[model samples]
Structures are given as structure tokens and as C-alpha cells.
Target: MTQQPVDDIEIVAALFQLARSGAIYTKEVLLIEAKKLFPDVPEERLLDCRRQLGERLKGSDYLGYSDEYDRQRRRKAS
Candidate 1:
């Protein structure tokens, strides 16, 4: 059986939703939520999606997952 392709937009939306909720979250938490949205998608693909989101959203209002702590949070106003 072939796995369906994961939607990058949806994954990014979920990540953004989680990050913008005024709370800190670990990468694990973000993955868990994404998995819930795309249960059949491979874990590797989801991780890649998360990585891409981090890179694209870097320095934006939403802070992506960090390797140093594996946590995500919203950027504060300057």
C-alpha cells in the first residue's frame, strides 16, 4: 500500500495554530497534533514538513521548533 502525500499547507497551519496559542510546545506535541490530522502520513514526512515550516517561518510572528530545546513558541513584539 502506498502512503498518501502529506499536505504541507495543512501541516504548517497546524504548527502555526499551536505556536500562536500563547503557549510553549515541544516538537513532540506539534508532531502529535499533525499526526492526528494526517494519521496515515509517514513520520519522516511529517518531520520534514515541520523542518520546512521552521525554516520558512523563521523571524516571523510564529517561532518554529528549535533544535536546542525542541520547543516552539510565538515571537514577542519588538
Candidate 2:
């Protein structure tokens, strides 16, 4: 299936929600939350989405994944 274009705003929102929910017990669950926020996003786009969100949360420090990305994003408003 062709994936839709997912903007940064939705990606940031999903990160915050997943972090706030505090129940992302599994990778699949995290992916589900991502898809919920970005319906057009494909499964493989999760990492890309996370990276996009990281850019907003960490500026150019988006050096891949970090344990702090979600925590920091959750503290900010959507």
C-alpha cells in the first residue's frame, strides 16, 4: 500500500501521547500509537517519524533514538 505523507506535527503529537500514556509495553504498541496519530504513515515509517519528532524536540541533536525524546516531548503542548 502507498503510504501518505506524514508531517512533523502529527509525529510530535504521537510521541507525547505515547510517553504520557506510560504504557508502551511493547514495540507493536508504540507503532500502533504512531499510526493512530498519523494514519497515512506506513509501519516502516515509525523510525523516520521518531527521527522527525526528535528533530523538533532536540534540534540538530537528533542523533537517532534516545530515552529522553518522549519524556521531553510529553512535557510540551501538542
Candidate 3:
């Protein structure tokens, strides 16, 4: 059977979906999750997804969202 192909847009879309879920998703987990969504995503595109995800997230206004995810992540790391 032929393996399905993955695309950059799909990977970025998954990142956005995960963020909307309000979970503390890290770069590593996000990559894994993206893999699950698009098993055939190229490693290069996956790397780009990480960069794009960060760019989009860094520009987002956290005003409408709670910091629980952020605080919990910090506490766990600490």
C-alpha cells in the first residue's frame, strides 16, 4: 500500500488546533502530534512547522485566554 503524504499546511493546522484546545503543548509533543496527524510529513517540513507554530503563537494576544496552561507548564518544568 502507498503511504499517504503530509503537507506543511496540515502540520500547521494541527498545531493551531492543539493550541485552541488550551493544553500546554510543547514543541516536542507538538511534533509528535503532528506526526500522528500526518505520518508522512517530511522532517524538513516538520521543522518548519515548529518555527511557524512559534511565530503564530508568539504573536497571539493571551488576553482572552487563561494562563493556567502556561503556569502549569512552568511549575512542571521547575
Candidate 4:
């Protein structure tokens, strides 16, 4: 059986939803699932998507997964 092809937007959306729903926690787990959806996707692309999502989802009532990247930024700014 062939796996369905997923686009970047779809992958990002899935990751966002999963994070918000508490289905995915760390970046490691997110990549594992993202690869399942789009096997040919590169890790760099997924990392980029994760960065974008963290920016978009920060401080917008998303209490599911804390943005560790933003936390690091705060730690550095202090």
C-alpha cells in the first residue's frame, strides 16, 4: 500500500493541532509523526515548520505545549 502525500501546510497544521491537543510533546515525537505523514520530508523542513508554529502559537491561549524555544530566548534576554 502506498502512503498519501502530505504538503508542508498540512504537516504544520497537524503538528500544531497535535501539540494543542497534547498528543505530541517534544520535537522528537513530532518528527516521528510528521515523517509518517510525509515520508520524504526532510528533518530541516520539519524543524523550520516547528519554528514557525512556535512563533505563531505563542501567547495565543495555547496552553498545551510550552514553547521551549521562547523560554530559551527569555533566559538569554534576562
Best lDDT goes to which candidate? Answer: 4
lDDT string, candidate 2, 1-78, tens digits: 987776666676777578668787665677777877676667667767666654566564556455476667877856
- Which window of ten consecutive residues has the lowest lDDT sum in model 1? 69-78
Error of 4 at 62 (Å): 9.3
Per-residue error for 53 in candidate 3, Å, reads 1.6
In order, the Cα lDDT scores of the candidates are: 0.72, 0.68, 0.73, 0.76
lDDT of 3 by residue, 1-78 (tens): 986666667678778888678774577777777777666667678879879877776668467343666778899999
TM-score for every candidate vs. truth? 0.58, 0.44, 0.57, 0.61
Cα displacement (Å) at residue 73, model 1: 18
> How much is the lDDT of residue 59 in candidate 2?
61
Error in Å for residue 45 of model 2: 2.7
Indicate whether candidate 3 or candidate 4 has the larger lDDT: 4
Instruction: Give the best candidate by TM-score.
Output: 4
Q: For each predicted model, how many residue pairs clash, with residues at least 3 apart or on different chains?
A: 0, 0, 0, 0
Least accurate 10 contiguous residues by lDDT in model 3: 61-70
Off by over 4 Å in 2: 1-6, 52-78
Rank candidates, TM-score, best first.
Answer: 4, 1, 3, 2
Superposed Cα deviation of residue 68, candidate 1 (Å): 15
